[model samples]
Target: MLVTLREILEQAEQGNFAVGSFNSPTLESVRAVTEAAEELQSPIILSHAEVHNDIIPIEIIGPIFIQFAKQASVPVVVHLDHGSNLNIIKKAIDIGFTSVMIDASHMEYEDNIRIVQEVVDYAHKHNVSVEAELGMMTSSGIGGEETQGGEHHATQEAEDYYTDPLIAKDFVQKTEIDALAASFGTVHGIYVQEPNLDIKRLKAIYENIGRPVVMHGGSGLEIEDYVNVIQSGVRKINYYSYAAKAGAQAVKEYIQQNQNLFYHDYTVVAKQAIKEDVKRAMKIFMNNGY
Candidate 1:
């Protein structure tokens, strides 16, 4: 069953469980995630980031994602994660994406709003859901051509780096985004240190925003943290880097252990590794199917 973010998340808000948004780095990863979701009978999201287009172009992968979402037994949302290009956003919608994130988190506040509002207006007209981020989300210094060579801007003031509840209210009202990806203390990629979530801040945003709260940078958080944030009212969570790493490492280990295995055989092992990891994530998130 193909479903929108709003369709899946309204149930999450009522049931108090977070839906895992796993990024599809390859068509294989999407296949793995879909299998896991069907086996668990859980509603799942498959995402492809704008930054990863160099590795897996959205146009090449969007149709496959749409096909998987439509054919899946459990609910699925085909989402474009961290969309920076409006043209790509429009293309993904035309390619049949159920949801998109018009990420202008790096832009100035009003500029971010302007960019997101334009996307929302266009996406809404086509009946597609939109997600927009507020505040600055930091990186744990991993992934991509752009960031691989640069130093990560560490959080000097936690509040300065994270979303403000007041601005969240206004951002939602102005952008009309279906979901808000709120940055608390979590950063993208792997955790460089002990990850501590600002549960109070998450609670404050939930109390004020009156919209589905999304937790990105969810790869390294402790299981308890997922429980805390979902309870604090986060309906959707993004998990990617961990799955990417798991599949790669699994293939590497498999090939090394079985030196005679064919090159194509690695993909077979990789999909299973990705599938099991995705299933574990879905279980950890505890989706009680609505």
Candidate 2:
């Protein structure tokens, strides 16, 4: 069933498990995640960023994701991830997204609050949940195009953009967001090496902010790191790179093994491969049952 983000995150917080928020760029990716959730009896969130929409187009994938959410046996929340513009956020809300994120963390604190407040007001009116980001995440070392109309930045400098605990508290209280994505020590995209997560800082934010916190850039973390972070107060974990890698690797292996296989036949192999990967992630997330 399609459910609100507040309900999902609250359940995750109370149960001491982080909900897996998977990013899907295609129908196969969406199928893998929803099927995994149903098979495992775990609640999950299907997330897509506006940046991705630039490639796949929201009008094409939005309805498909919503349909999958409604058909899932377990509660599933269709969410907009890292939404940089109010226009896109509004479109998600209008299209029946259960949750929308207003990521204005790159802006000044006051401006961030103002933008989030606008989203919260609009989302709440439609009985949807809103998530706001406190810090910015960027690719490490490599300079990538800014997806949300911001300057190019590096993940190594993310510590400078880390969310202030006090400012986070004030931002949440002022904007009335249902959840806040706090940047402890994670960045968007794959890490060049093992990333050192700031667990102590995350604990402080969880203890001080008094709301469910989200951790993005979950693809490269060690299992122990993920467990420790979730225990500390990361109620929602967003993943993208791992799934993409799994899908691509599966198709490559299939082609290499079967030299005569047609390109059209590869979709089935890719789907099964990604499905298994999603299930593995769901198990690691430990969100099964309750």
Candidate 3:
């Protein structure tokens, strides 16, 4: 049934495995995530990014997420990802989001501390979990056009922009966030080239924080990298672009192969493709299914 993000990650932490947070902008995507979780009996996080609200507003999507989480056989959590707007996050909490992220990484360290603390204080009072980003995951910087949603963070920042273990340790101590999404070597979306994860950096962050760590932009990472991340103490990974792209590509191929493409055919194909991808991802995150 529906579970808190804290609850989901605690088990992952204990098992030394990671849970995949798959973004879903539509009902089909949510269905695919739930189906995969059931098939593997794995706990899953179903996410809706703030940027995608333009297509499917969070208010409209929130109830559906709650319903799906409630009906799922395995534990499921509805999470708001990359939420910068305090009001929007509050609304998400009010409307039944089990977890919410406050992305203040774009701000100065002090400012981030202030904003995230404000959110953590409020969320904790309501019995909801809070996730905050400490490092700039992408190189685009915060104000850029791409920082709006699940945009894969830029790798260009890796050299000089990675999260300082000391700063992150302090941030977590002060803010008391349920989880922290810090940067190592991971980026968002498809990789132009394979990413070499900074295992040392991740290990450092994990040691200092000693809490559930989150990795965003996990769509195209190698299976080995995923294994390394989970082994390094990453409890949750955000995976989206790959699953969504898989569904869209399947629908396109189905239409091309059939002379008469029907509406229902596309829906069925999309669901099947998405479900398979989610299943594949779950297997990786859980180390080949539990």
Candidate 4:
């Protein structure tokens, strides 16, 4: 069933398990995510960022997302992630997205709050949930390319761009976002090396914020990190790079193994590959619940 982001996160908070928010840029990706959720009996969020909208076009992908959400056995929330502009966020709301993320983290604090508040006011009026980011998550992957206009990928050091607990308290109190995405030592995209998760910082922010928190750049984290972070108060975890890579790798392996691949159908190969990838990720996210 299609549900609000608040509703999904609330359930996660109550159940003591984080819900997986996977990015879907195509029909195969959507099917992979939703089918995994259905098989696991786990609630999931299907998210697409502004960059993805630009690539796939919202007019084509929006209705498909809605239809997939409606048909899923488990509850699903269709969300827009990392939406930096007001107009794009509004379009997502109009296109039937259950949740919209207003990512103004790169802006000054006050400016970020102003934009987020604007989105919150509008989303609330339409009964849609809003997610706001508190800190900038530097990335070393395709996201970096998207944000930096194809600039060189730079690894983010431990900087203070992340949300301070005291300031987080104020930001949440002021903007009133449904969920907060805090950057407690996690960077966007795949890390060049293993990134240490600042569990203590995460717990402190969660304590101060007094709301369900989200963890982005979840693709490269260790299993122990995931467990600890979820225990700390990460109600929603976002994954994209790993899932996409898995799908592509599966397709490549299939082609390499089959000599008569020329006669093979593309749709079936892609769907099966994506399905396996999603199932594998579901095991990790759901912890073998299915």
Model 2 misplacement above 4 A: 141-152, 155-157, 287-290
List the pairs of residues colliding in candidate 1. none
lDDT of 2 by residue, 1-290 (tens): 99999999988877889899988887888988888899989999998878887568787888988999998899999999888878989999889999998888878878888888888999999999998888766565331222453322462465776777877778888998888898777766657767878888888888877889998777768888888888888889888776777788889988788868786677777778878887887898884234
C-alpha lDDT of all candidate models, in order:
0.85, 0.82, 0.85, 0.80
State every prediction's TM-score relative to the real structure. 0.94, 0.94, 0.94, 0.92
Give the per-residue lDDT of model 1 (tens digit) for 237-286.
Answer: 89887887788899989977885878678888889998988888899888
Candidate 4, residue 241: lDDT: 79
Q: 1-290, model 4: which lDDT tens digit per residue?
A: 99999998888887788888888888877887887788778898999878886679877888899999998899999999888868888899999999998988877889989999999999999999999988777676654225522112344356555668889999999999999999877766657767867788899999999899998888767777877888899888888877776666767877888777663455556767666766665566566221
Clashing pairs in 3: 138-153, 138-154, 139-154, 152-188, 153-188
Worst 10 residues of 4 by lDDT: 144-153
Pick by TM-score: 2 or 4, better one: 2
Per-residue alpha-carbon lDDT of candidate 3 for residues 143-217, written as tens digits (9 for 90 to 100): 212455333456444656677889889999999999999888766665666777888988899999979999987
- The local distance difference test score of model 3 is 0.85
Candidate 1 accuracy as lDDT = 0.85
Q: What would the C-alpha RMSD of candidate 2 be, to one decimal place?
A: 2.2
Which ranges of candidate 3 are over 4 A from the true structure? 139-146, 149-157
Report how far off residue 60 is in candidate 1 (Å).
Answer: 0.9
